[model samples]
Target: MHGARKAFACAVILATTALTSGQSFADEEVNVYSYRQPSLIQPLLDAFTAKTGIKTNVVFSDKGLGERIAAEGENSPADVMLTVDIGRLDTAKQLGIAEPIKSEVVAKDIPSQFRDVDGDWVGLTARARIIYASRERVDQTAITYEELADPKWKGRICTRSGQHDYTLGLIASMIVHHGEAETEKWLVGLRDNLARKPTGNDRAQVKSIYAGECDIALGNTYYMGQMETNDAEPEQKDWAASVRLIFPNAEDRGTHVNISGVILNKYAPNRDNAMKLIEFLTTPDAQEIYAETNFEYPLTPGVAIAERVKGWGELKPDDISLSEIAKYRKAASEMVDRVAFDDGPAS
Candidate 1:
């Protein structure tokens, strides 16, 4: 009888040890697969951990991340997926990789237009698609999305490859405004005007203007603000000082805008924790951090713009639903390639 009791006690102890080890592993961390670069997202993750005692482990990659998540499917270890641009988010949704996130905090903080109509994802912040022109070489009043194609501006425009997501979205907005044929014509005309083969990111375009390589380019509003505020790169400040920002078509459709957003993975092990993180990100405090740190605008209504962002001035954004922008991505890509805009400068 004594020996049997001792054996039973050992069995109980082993079972308890296994259970405690499993719970410890589960409670200690949440996994995130992010398309946003690590530097841009680490602060938020750090803050979330400090507040919740839930540590975050992130895997950041710009490409193939969506595919990897989908491939993982029900086995995916990712609890949250954060990405910029509606196209990628929509792709994730269409691929059935994201589960609907039902949270009152998310629904209240983000606008209906910015969140998935079915609640699959929520936009956290917005970036405006705006025009940047060299103050010394171009007339600021001449700024307009259509003006980028003007013959007068030929040999004076510098932009990245049309194949890039930013340019694709910009051209997609044009398609929304003017239809496909007209957009193609505008793209061809814009192609003819390239000061150099489309090369570099938005910041590089500003650098081009500073070097007198070109006088005008299309860039995200945040990049402009970031450059202006960057004391680390005196040249970035000088480049920013030499350029002027123009929010296009304020009298018509208004300026085009895009978002950085988050979705709960379909197989998230910690759905409640994921919802909490998303809600936390949309709070006014987190929204302000997003704006100030990334040079983006808050998605939440009534949230005050950061001073540096406000200093860039107000904008009347196009009322077109961002979902509509996601819809046109493919056609926009085809139009870009058809015009050979990716072929560098025209002979």
Candidate 2:
């Protein structure tokens, strides 16, 4: 790891906030090993402590936290697993580290489509994989996942690495809904459409559109909010303004939706408090906080989104079960290489 990244990992692993306003859970704490940034989850943790007086300890990692927990086995101090994608959540479940939950509150508040059938994991928020179209260059207001493969769009699309987890989730969904053979053909078409070799984070794809390198791109919904509200990178605001988001496949199977979800560690030392925290995260109050702070769509009903996001229009999320989507990741990873999707267009 680079020096800065190593320092960041150490800081996130050791950092433990007490959330001590009225009462503290230093004694009744729940340990969370997360794949999400501490800043993104701190508000909810603080609210959980303030409401239930059960504090949380977090260890953040972009990778390897799961391996460490697996190595620790039943003696692990980890109480909860928090992450951003169904594939990761399902991986934890398959690794036998996740406990199957039996919470009525979670079942009632979270929709069945967003939670595992056996309750090993539950999605807290959802985002759509949609198109970011350049305002000045693209005339259309809508498109479809199928349409990306159309020859009309050749040399007009850009994306991050085809093998990135979010992109993998999308590719996995494509494989699930469309058979492997057809999906490969679609992959070839998409590959031939790239404005440049697939590169950068999702935000960089938007920047490419802003720079006129491509007319449209694939990105998650929350990133638009992040780009628009970013103060540190004020130019990202202009990047945000240059593109209009199009919800793909909206008139058909609906846009492919992904999630930020949570899990219960099977041997969580603080099982009761951990369950409390899980149930709390699924409730409207916490969902509202998540919606306002992170610009994510709440899985729970009746939670309104940010006004700016609301203006983008309603989401007709493809109701495909993400659990089913997780099964095709290996095939999707293979297809990316088979088609040389990251090498840009061959035309």
Candidate 3:
């Protein structure tokens, strides 16, 4: 009950096996537990149902779908689980809420580097942790993660908490490259360069750069898309216009990336249908729908990224393996506390 939440739209609704409202139950259907907003995935689901005629039912929540399923135990109706962040996906595996998905099609569709080695989870799309540099103040056309620590940037950098998932993933990847000691030293330099105490989500960092509080900030690539297109918050568009994106380590190992992905529920009642859904999601067409809807990059090989995201320029994903990078997350979290990274620099 701690983090569990029942979806208000249809928490315990029975899966409508009824294909046609006027008719009885259809051939088959699947129940989906989704952390992603229903709007982002509904178009693809509608397309899938239109094609396959297999009815799909959704229980959407911003958080707690995983815990809710786990509490249901073996009787849970969830056929598939969809969420973002490999860390959360991996946690679901550790929690016994997920079952391995082994299929020749699934194996071939998702690159091994972006999925679980044992096939417990699979990445569906990608996002980069990129720098938001002031268009007017920053003169450099190129930059690297290593350079964020350089003394020249002192009092000029902004970031969310070093403890946030995005930053932790970046640091975990750094540990993979530089080992813990040197990475800790590098973190100290980055902390010293802080324009303010580490705070807020990625977009808030971009706003800091816009406000003249910092010359550069670290943020996710998709947030630029949200900011620019936001109608409710028009000021975010101005915030977006103030900075240019820089994919750190672009010339070398490439930028750090995180993913939005899926898992097969351990208690899936409609196993075959769930497998069908997962495979369908990885197809080039489905990947495009997912990518374009969220302004994210497609994970399936050769599928084009969203046109808006494309304008940021080509991204060569870092050479590190997400499975390997996930291994260092705990150490990276400890390192953040070890350095007091969110406390601002020493006075």
Candidate 4:
């Protein structure tokens, strides 16, 4: 029976080798061109890899990814394009760089208002363009999008440049909420009250408030949570502790929330894998990871929010469809320039 035992061992070794070889062949690596910074997205990518064994390769760039993808055209190696705002996503769709993908998983997880009706792209997580008020300086009851333009807020408001995507999206939503004429007026008013030249990112705006440079600032809700929970630096923890997050326009249109979403590249080499990845991301499990890691709201209903997010209280998201905001981006940019906002330092 020694010869029989030897044969059985040989058979087991061959089976294991064949299994490993098959997995290596089916690995099917997907290339992702992401607008999000690495720190904000790598964790999610790692998780997906751990669960699916489908290796993910990513090129992270904060700017010009859309243009690069467009430049590559049908020859592009990118299988998916991930971006932060509706304006940028619309640009990709307008350029015909993204192809429509139909998946019941994506359709069910993402709200119709957060994606293209034709299924070209789907939103995964959402962030509100809300106000951060200094606990020691501002009255909570006086908070509103319109209030930011009030004379009282003059010399007390801090914000990043209107040219930034986050600010541009907020302006686009304003264009939708209050037509061009009124939006122009609000832009002028907000511009006139800037605490410093439109500089730095949302986190910088929050830091400025903590430094006593301003009493109120425009920023995303996630940044506040990031700062509070960040163990990497003491200053970030302090910045988060110094302010309170307020949902703007609660009574009227509700707070404007934007999303980070993905679309299949028009020239995807592995269309089936691309659809699977998109489907995986929109699932309740993946959506929860997004909310917990990125501090953004899940696009899928019934997904529980992270405890830190729940602490900020519930939000009444603006009912306006994201496409409406994307539609008015051109007008919003023109208004931004017409007011000479890019000319000199804001306020």
Candidate 5:
């Protein structure tokens, strides 16, 4: 361990010890470094604490978390790291900051496709990348990822930056399915079909559909829930009302799916407690919290999906493992740049 990292870890230990002077479970805390928004995971953490009395200390941010932990080295106080997306989790493994989450409980609960082959990470929830098609303008009952490139849809699709992880994930899946040469050709076709320069987050794409700027868009399944239930921005309800969800390729290879996952930090100071929390997270009760609170599909086989999520449509996820898809991410990203996909449809 580096001296600076060791010293910092020691300081954190001492501070935690001081704070827990009178508490029964003071020494049972687990440190978390999360790339997910705190609000998204707070309920789960609270449930864990309530069940086991193991307190969670979290440092949350959306960017640079992997770099932060890598810089912290062997003495990193982070017991667990949480984030969404296979790309980020694979990046952490490549950075060498992960420990195998090798619990029989986890292996049995989470399906193989949702787990890293080396046990470096485990997915807790899954969301599909589906098409949001305008109810008024688009009459298609079904679509395929490949169909997006058909000349019939020219100047009729909207999307976020092709470089975004969500877009890249879908693109990566395309590479896995079609190989580099054909996937590259598909990217050109899809790029030319764009209604405008790929811009905005998934929600923004839905908003564009509402405005008649496009007839269809690519977005995650859960964004629909967030938009429909958005009381703070009630206008989002109308946006949600304007579109219908299409699970691409439901009759064939199925829609591309991604996960929100957790990893056991390589240098977990409280390894046992961290493992306990991880195990707790996979249990049916915790999985229920994930579904009800986040409107996501639980990884546990028997757990029910959120009713609102079910209302959107049945999701038949692509059977290819995320690890397989991740293998093609670099190629997918390069293809995006090579095709000048973000430049919008060539006029």
Candidate 6:
């Protein structure tokens, strides 16, 4: 499936490249390289074009966008890059393809923690890494990231692979709070509590809970909204119905949250229009459209959240800097391997 997706993405990129090969600095259009699907983001792009009178051109793929832009060097037509996960945003900064954002609008609208200290990237929306507890078997009203390791929950927890970006993000946050030594111990304990070998995406874990294969699983909050609204696969609605969303650590440090973010390409040919687009994206109207489209929390304060997202209860996001979490991501991946977390419960 991944290969198929990559192949299709390559075809799309080739087509977009053909269209953009002749772009010059004087062009009125802004070119975008994105990891987000066009369907998921087209509304915002359309809205931008409608408001600003500048055409938006997009090249999209599930991965390799930053590398592609870097490989294109100064001739790259990409003006803005859009993607999810702190890891990808950090990688764009590391690749030297990101131009630091200096917009006063961005600084005023986005919180400091969600924007890079170096100003290379800024988050647009947020999602909490939360627990999906079975409505039938779990009576608890709340849980913490630390409690997933308790002996009482032995053979009860389910999750995707620890190496996945979402899991790594949470583990990275744990390392930030508890240190590497303590975080490793927690991973070992959590490994022993798994119901089965780690597998599947966030939505799959919720399916497992609905099937009674596990009492709890870790997943992002927007997935609940997706599952609940899935008309194509009605079974997912039942899966969503079977679990209660628990924002981990909400009572203390708050839930571990990650972002979907954007970067300005260092080689942008349409820099002025790109800056306008970037600044426009930070406005409340664009943020509201983003939140409604993706079921994610708006990064701009006071933007309305999606109705389904609001029903999940209020989110008190962990106040820790995401850049700090990004720093420990490598260490967190190492801890996942050191503990052999995907090997499932120790028999």
Best by lDDT: 5
| Superior by TM-score: candidate 1 or candidate 5 | 5
Q: Give the alpha carbon lDDT tens digit for every residue of 182-203 in model 3.
A: 9999999999999899999989
Quote the positional error of residue 142 for candidate 2 in Å.
1.3
Steric clash pairs (candidate 1): none
Stronger candidate by lDDT (4 vs 5): 5
Residue lDDT tens for model 2, 1-347: 44522433455543444556555354677888899898899889888877777667788889977677777786677888899988788888888888898899999999898999888899999988989999999999879888899999988999999898899999999988888999999989988988899999999999999999999999999999999999999999999999999999888888999999998988887899999999999999999989988988999998888787787767899898988898898889999998888888986
- State model 3's lDDT: 0.85
Winner on lDDT between 3 and 4 is: 3
Clashing pairs in 6: none
Model 4: how far is 174 from its true place, Å? 1.1
Tell me which of candidates 1 and 5 scores higher on lDDT: 5
TM-score of each: 0.89, 0.94, 0.92, 0.90, 0.94, 0.92
* Candidate 3: residue 323 lDDT (0-100): 90
Tell how far residue 322 is off in model 6, in angstroms.
0.7
For 1-347, candidate 4 gives per-residue lDDT tens digits of 34422332343211111122345445566677788776677667766666666666677777887788787766666789889988888888888888987887788788899988767778889999988888888777436787777887788888887788888898999888889999889888888887767888999988898899999989998997889988878799888888888898787778999999998998886677777788889988789889989999998999988899888877889978888888888888888889976543353
TM-score: which is higher, 1 or 6?
6
- Model 1, 117-206: lDDT tens digits are 888778898899887888898766535688778898889888988888888888888888899999989999999998989999999999
lDDT of 6 by residue, 1-347 (tens): 34523433455432211133344433367778889888888888878766666777777788899998888787777789999899999889999999999999999999999999999999998999999999999999888999988998999999999998889999999999999999988898899999999999999999999888999999999899889999999999999999999888889999999999999998887899899989998999999998888899999988888888989988999989999999999999988988899898888
How many backbone overlaps does candidate 6 show?
0
lDDT tens digits by residue: candidate 5, 207-238: 99999999999999889999899999999999
Q: TM-score of the candidate numbered 2?
A: 0.94
lDDT of 1: 0.80
Query: Lowest summed lDDT over 10 consecutive residues: which window, candidate 3?
Result: 1-10
Candidate 4 all-Cα RMSD: 8.9
lDDT of each: 0.80, 0.87, 0.85, 0.80, 0.89, 0.88
Residue runs of model 1 more than 4 Å from their true location after superposition: 1-28
Superposed by TM-score, candidate 5 places the C-alpha of residue 74 at a distance from the truth, in angstroms, of: 1.6
